[model samples]
Target chain A: MGDGPSNEKGAQIMSLFEVLTIIVPSTLLTAAPLIFTSLGGVFTERSGVVNIGLEGLMGVGAFTAAVSTLGLEHAGLGDASPWIAILFAAIAGGIFALIHAVVSITFRADQTVSGVALNFLAAGLTIFLVKMIYEGKGQTPYITHNIDKINIPLLSKIPVIGPIFFQQVTYTSYLAIFVSILVWYIIFKTPFGLRLRSVGEHPAAADTLGINVIRMRYIGVVLSGVFGGIGGAVYLVTITSNYNVSTIAGQGFLALAALVFGKWHPIGAMGASLFFGFAQALSITSQQIPYLDRLPSVIMLTAPYVLTLIVLTGFVGRAEAPKADGVPYIKGQR
Target chain B: MIKLVKKINWMTLLVPVISVILGLLCGAVIMLVIGYNPILAYQSIVESIFLQPYYTGETIRAMIPLVLAGLAVAFAFRTGLFNIGVEGQLMAGWLASVACAIVFGHLPRVILLPLSVLAGGAAGALWGYIPGLLKAKFKVHEVISTIMMNYIALYTTAYIIKNFLYTEGERTPTIPAAASLASPFLANLTQGSRLHWGFIVAIIAVVAMWFILWKTTKGYELRAVGFSPDASQYAGMNVSRNIILSLTISGIFAGLGGAMEGLGTYQYMTINSTFTGIGFNGIAVALLGLNTPIGVVLSGALFAGLQTGGLTMQSNAGVPVELIQIIIALIIFFVGSGYVIKWAMGRLTRKGHK
Candidate 1:
């Protein structure tokens, strides 16, 4: 794969091999955050709550992770700071999400409107705190202990798959994929999952079955917060290595899109995240590829969004959400 | 007078007023928690907007696009659709208006100015029409589609500018005087602020929204569909068509808002790495305004004041400008959870009776 090609076919094959090595690992890195956040979306939406504020939740997570890591590193935590910061992010994200859960659940406000408010609040509050904490700076300073990539010991020695999957990758990516499968099990195979889905599908029926509708929804929303927080932290430590207003950008929205595109299933969401991540990878790597570099960069830049639109138009009519999704549960109504 | 007072809907009037006060209070609390003097912060905001001519002018200038953006969101809300694509539509409009102005630089102001603005509306409408069409035909959700389109607009517009209108400073060349909305008279009146003639256009858009939503048969059908799509369909109104029309009209308002920024405020389009955020703020504006035209104007001015005045607060009171954002967000939350307010209000009225 490294030497000069003797023939045209050999050169094409070598390039393909080279491209795979670069693209696969990058795709995993990019998809890791989305995988976590979209799984969060899956939980929230499946419990009949719509969380457009995942973007804001992610922002809160990123900010918390950055600040905590910096603080912990200053406290002489060494390499453990970033990992511990993820837990802090999850707590912050969960607390921030409680605002959405309370407003939409207990207060029975318009869920979408509440979610929008949550986004605004998260964006505003995080930056406001940043300014207050960082001596009026608009962003946080970069943390010293960013999470590093590692190759799996035995797996990195395997022939083709080694370099692509097990080499030079962050453990967080594997954790994200693993969590999605666990979420699928928890959401599909468990009685708790049954109650959660039942509440979303038909709250009155679920209520009749002695299920606590409001409590289930609250749990769903908080879980989303936890997962989304981890996602944001992972992105911060592995990719951005700091927190800024633009650090999370539209990844949360992309995760939401993945959730919808995946038809609200956890594994399906993970698959969709991978696809979107692949599109993102293509855009970033396009300038490096010989033939792809010639095309206008906008095509690659907008591919994920454009492709999501196309995919939705083609298949979303059949993509049904949970029956009572976005509807607040009221006692003894209808 | 007493009878007329009794006939009024106090809840509508009280909810927003209380929400604003509560939002400000929340901002104050946050500031105090952060070791800043909230009183000084708010005082500076008020003083700057009222006492300084430039800040006053800037506040009004800022209100122009905000008013139009609020109308876009409110108009769609009234028609039972969420036009989250306003950001994308605004970008498309910004690009189209500037592109038109630059290309038609030779035309008279009477022809070129309106043409450029109309081009913006057209571009926005076209951008809006896609999601509307998809929703109408394929049942695709507009929220997700519009969100996707925002990115598409961001990247696509950046690409177009880089490829075709490349110039120094990473932005397009300025439009000719004929197409510019800059008014020397307004600038002089505002003490050399960036105030422009777009204010009039925003006022007209507000009135247009009110007229179209309340005075026309099409508007009636649109509102009916919004009230109940199934009932409207059974009553022989075209639900799908109303949905499409609602989003398209919403796009026009959003696009015009963009034109205000492109032709009036800046006079050229710069590639944007993120959304201008006027669209998202429109949601807060519309919600706080209760989706009414008169209400939108008042809320738009209030938000404009906060934003412009926030700079003064930041400079004068050692407070951050983001405090204003927190205040606005709190207002949206308070307004959205009107249930809580109403419940409390109910208890207060009962106590008064006792």
Candidate 2:
């Protein structure tokens, strides 16, 4: 009888560990897309181009990925469908982003307004196309094949850390992490990064140095599109396995918030994305926790956004945008 | 001839007109590509909005909130700010008005209705104040703060409705008739349409917006700051205070929009999982209207007509209502690229001179 109580306590500790294993893996999966998209935001904002149309770009990517995967699967590209879809999505996203570039850069349209319009355009066009393709339906057919989780051969056999990080994790998540680090190095350590930063900070100075400000800005915007597209495609193939109007809902915005909350740094954005991912995972799994069940789930739902606002107000007072950010560069005007 | 042409303000009128035409033309091309009759589609839309009394009333009813929301955006734009939190502010006002109605619903119509609306406006003002204060105090971008505030308002209101005001089926109880904006006289006149007293409220708001923006000394300060904040600061104006006041007033308009929906249209608040697209649409409306008082109402009417007519077009012409959204988006895109249109027009004029 005395051993009964101790046995129950031992089981409780085991269950707690089990709970974490599930939540932590899910959190990484959820955060991978945000990290990629926010890194994209970092690239564009660092080059003095404001990309509020990441949501639209992501939507384009998600829709294109789903549609292309369906076609490729039909053509008998069984295991390779998702990979090919990602490539197609990235291309579509980069092409779509050129609209924002042409409007905001070439025509000197208001960047914010152009972004808003792009979102509406994306939503409308996607739904319209969906209806046309699906014979007056609102969504595409379900994707049969999805990206699978892979276990790292020997690394996943290690202790708790292995299960949390390597076991049963999507390859896309690891790729996202690697890309975040790679983007950080490129932004901070490369000559290209220096030129991009200089153009964002002072276009006149960059122009004086013979750097093509407009061309650099276009490349930054297109890079943002590529990363954001990949992020959306990853989210679709790994998380949802389908494309609808709501597939990329507000994730792009969440990524943007993460970008700003991370103070426009690649590494910081990754951390913020992971934090948001953890919060989302908690919200999904909170019912299983004894104490968490008592708390309202709305708090968790609002946490990422509210926490971002708090961070922006509290810690990021000096989080300055590049000086010439959002201004249309007119030659010889300054 | 030059003086006459200069006095015409052609640039202001031309861009929006040309953009609208271009949007419609593009919409037509899309319909043609889809093997639908664009002319029939457009005619059905026009007939439903104009000839049908019920649809006209519905269109006007829809315009009430949109006009106010546009004013909300336009007000902030005039003060050199973007108030994307209109969605959040509108939502806060919606819940506050409904909550007030539930509490004070026993009172007479005159007292309860106005009180509930004022409560809503006050709640929205509070919601708007957060980002404005953040911008002024911490140098936080209003854009980011306002966007965050939107989600916060979204989840917070959903929680409030679920926990505190749960009537049934993810919606609150309808307000008492005493506090409702529904007018039997207006409804009967409009063939049982949902038109209400909120139309009067919208007109009053428009006049008030005009007066406050053009007639008052505070208006001058707001406009001056919008022109150049540094210049206004050097001229002894408090830039931060103006920013706060501008956002606060914008919040009032947006909050009133929510109040119109609650007391006027639905007569209750439902939990919204997604943002009501009206806030984003208001940005387009404000842009189309050139942020002017009268222009906002006209453009609001135009957009509301498209929406109301879109339903009829869908039913009659076998065209999906999504086409209207595409058209609207195209209009915004064309409007955003007005400089291109201006350049093209300049070339045309120069060619005529040759």
Candidate 3:
């Protein structure tokens, strides 16, 4: 494997085409989850609810998806377990997000504190469940079947785009891209989007127009949970193999960084997530690249986070949040 | 005299007390559901924390870092800056202290120990200052920047420890006795426990945090800025400077907390693949303490005891230590929703009077 290519394939070694083929698929898979979760962030923040509990919500989704898939497959549900698991994850995530909504929106608790509490609660609860089910172990059993890669017939025949984009693609990754455009339409084009933005920017004005501010915020937060849950499920089935305490490690936060770095727009967040995904892919593929192997791996490992910081500080041009973001809307308070 | 007693605003004290009861009750329900004996579990935790000398000392040892961390968080909270970066600051501080100890190993104990502590604080200040500077200059939210800072700190510290200072394993070389905070007398007094003089440092931190926030003009400025940046600006105060100053000071306290862990408890720094969770735990302590110096000390000790006792609960009650984490999380949830309790109580009192 290490030898220079002697044949046609060998000549393709370290070639730009070869590099793009390997890197593009890996980057898409890594960024898919981030795309979903950051889009979730966009929904919630755009409606003026700061949903930092995406981390916990993602955990709930991942754990639920894993356990449900395991149970369903055990019950002889053939070939359909993964889809069912995603459904379970979305429901679980939405349910878990209700805690954040009740505490932050209904009771007017500090959003960040509530989000932190949810994270702790999710971590403890999931591990506790793992122990109870697995007989003192901290992880679930790894399943054999996972989300499969598909090659589009005509698209896969294309010269350059076929190998890079069409082959070795998970349906979830395409779904993620499609959903990004869909969410952009829902957030920017539709009446619901208009009302949601109005509620976020000036709830009093929105309320004057008979728009229910509270309900809009709740919808925004709950949609975030749904998307974040799907993000977790996609990440578990496609990226990692099993459910454990570390399964959803920091992806939620990274997604949030992408959200802010992308200036909270759906397309922008998708772009930023792809950028982060590429950085992550580099960390894994650095050993394969002759030039990259010479550089210290630490730089690649830390690059995504540092880049997020730099992006926020440097090019966050008018990345404005909702005017009433993080503020509890009282009935008559100014 | 009767009116004075009635005007004491009983809710101020009652809120926390009631929240604790609610949290414990919820924890008990979880225990019962898991088929564990809730009474036995609680008993084991209490016994392990109080009845054993070694465990008692360990609890105190644990409380040293926790106390400083809580103070760090509470200090930031009081200044209206939510510092989610304490964990990163602590990591930075820990690495800096170990580096200082190793580099200045030839110095006398008096100079080396204090120098390492200062180095830790300085490193932490630098970490905290980034988010503060970002917020003050670029209008970046501290929460996002600080969270990013934490990931940076975690990987960077691990890389440094692995490549530069690794001694025997994934840890740095143990500091010499001259630079160590371990007290032979204290260890002997606690029956060979790992207790050290960091307790003294924790106390000093609490007092200093209290004094700095209450007695100084700088404290007043910070509080004013916290209360309302626009108002403080209108009053001719440097709101931006105060914001940066508060976060920097908070970082110092957290960094010193890391120093206690290095110089006092472990005498060496080990690389952590994940966050130590001390910083997040500090948030719980700060919230439970109501963001006051004395309150943080008391709450920090309480959490320390719970953590120390969690092990006994695991061994004695046949339960997982994760249960304690659930209880702690529940406690924070209850505390965060204190307004709900307050509103209910006010309604109850009014209905009773009517």
Candidate 4:
């Protein structure tokens, strides 16, 4: 696939159409899990709870999916059932999320520490589980076979956005985008959205207005867990297609960055996620691009993180958080 | 004397002890649920950390960095800066020291070792200063910058080790004997094992931190700024300069932590891995220590004990080393919830219990 002055696809200057093809398809594949995670962050932060453990939650979810796929394959289900494996991953990720929720939200602990704890927890636990399950092997079985790829025949042929992008996009990307829209609508237009936002912006005020702040925070956290779980499962199945130690890597943090970068808006989060996915995909494509590839590898790995730094530093909601995100909302005595 | 003892910050001492006990109790419950032999695991943990001298030495070795890392966090905590880049700083220190060793391989130990240590500290200071500068100048949150710095540090350290520092054969050059600070005397104390002068260095570092943080006028300025930057500014303190200084000193301590691991312990650095978890561990150490130098040293040693013994629990008791990590999480969770502990204490006191 060396496109540099070598052959047919190589010699032709990359058209905007060709660029969109390569960028879009890969962007969605990478963006799916990020969308789910950032969306989860949106809910949590909006409801006034910061979910730092998204990384750990995703790690646990990814590992659990891998383990479940193998266990299911061993249990006569065979490797053909990606759905079952993904389901198992969701459950595992949820359980992991629950650990963070219970520790941070329920117990009213420092959210950051709890989040960091989750990362360590997942790191240690996953490796330990790997040792136990694989005995000595560091990874689970490959999954590209079972992971289904969607093919929208007609949609695939559309000019710039079709074949290269739409045709190869995973089912999860579509689901993630839909979920973002759905979350935005629910958060903005629905009664529950107002309540969640109210609780975040001013928990005490919301409580005065008869909203259950604790309950809302709990709901927000639980929902976060669900999204995180989905993020993990989708990451393994759609993006990596196999589970290893570093499989989950920085995706959870990327989702957090997307959440911050998107200013906590669900739809905006989608755009932010696409940007990150494009940057990440571009890092790899740097090898193919003539002048772009000249950038150092260190800079390439750092591109996404540096972008996160810039976005968080400059663009995040400097206005104000929903007043009581980190503070534990007491019932009354205030 | 009794009255004075009562006046001392009991919370500082009791908090960690109480949390550790609670953590182990919770861990025991988890172990029971998993159907693991909790008793055997606990026995092995104690044996590994306390009963065996060599094992204890390993724990102390681990604690050196933990304490230093903890001091790094506590230094910022005192200033309300919450320097989260300790991990990044530690990595920077490790990279700087290792690079020094590689580049200045021919110097005598006297110059080489001191220069290497200084280089590590300087690198750490540089890493710490980035976020400090960002916060001081642009109002960019140090938390975000430091976290980003961590990712940058990880990848860069990995690249440097893999591409630049690794010997021609792909593995890094073995640290020369003269360059290594591992001492036979210290090793004998640990059953002729890997224990070294680093532990002593860690203690000395802790004392120095204590002096810098408590006795010095700069320390007073930092604490004042922590309480109220506005007030400190009114009192003629340069808040921005303090921010930068706080981070620089913090970074130096973290660099020393890396030196402990590198010159004193490993003698060579391995990259592309999670070599800088010490920075994260420092947060916990700072919390456990109540941001006091002595407390941090104690907490760091305890954490080191956990690390070394946890490895033992993995190899000997067949308990996953991750169990220690769970204990750590539980500890952090409990520490963060001081109100919960205070309430528990209040209830127990009311009930006429100790």
Which candidate model has the greater lDDT, 2 or 3? 2
Which has the higher TM-score value, candidate number 2 or candidate number 4? 2
Candidate 4 lDDT, tens digit per residue, B1-354? 987577345744666789998988987887787667778888887887778898887877778788889989998889988777898888888878877877888999888877888888899999888888878876766766787788888888888888877865444566666567789888888896688777777788788888877899998999999999999999999999999898888888888788777787778777655445788889988987888888887778778887787777777767777778878877887787766786777677669953
DockQ of predictions, in order shown: 0.80, 0.78, 0.75, 0.53
Measured with C-alpha atoms, the lDDT of residue B56 in candidate 4 is 82
Measured by TM-score, the strongest candidate is 1
Give candidate 1's TM-score.
0.97
Clashing pairs in 2: none
Expressed as tens digits, the lDDT of each residue in A1-334 for candidate 2 is: 8799999999998888778888888888999989988998998889888888888888888888888999999999997999999999889888888888889889989888888888888888888888888888888898998988778888888898788778878888888889999999998999999998998899999999999999999988898888888888889888988888788878999999889878888998999999999999899989988688888899898999988888877664555677777788778988
Docking class of 1: medium
lDDT of 3 by residue, B22-109 (tens): 8889989988987999899989989977888888999999999998889988998988999989999999999999889998999999
lDDT, model 4, position B278: 83
Lowest lDDT sum, 10 consecutive residues, model 1 chain B, at B3-12
TM-score of chain B of 2: 0.97
lDDT tens string, model 2, B1-354? 998687457877889889989999999999999998899999998998889888989999999999999999999999999888899999999899989999887899889999988888888888888888998888778888888998899989999999998888789999999889998888888889999999988999899999998999999999898899999999999999999898899998999999999889999999898888888888989999989989899889989999999999888888888899999988998999999998999889889999
Error of 2 at B314 (Å): 1.7
Better of 2 and 3 by DockQ: 2
**B153 Cα displacement, candidate 4 (Å):** 0.9
The alpha-carbon deviation from the true structure for residue A134 of candidate 1, after best TM-score superposition, in angstroms, is: 1.6
Worst 10 residues of 3 chain B by lDDT: B4-13
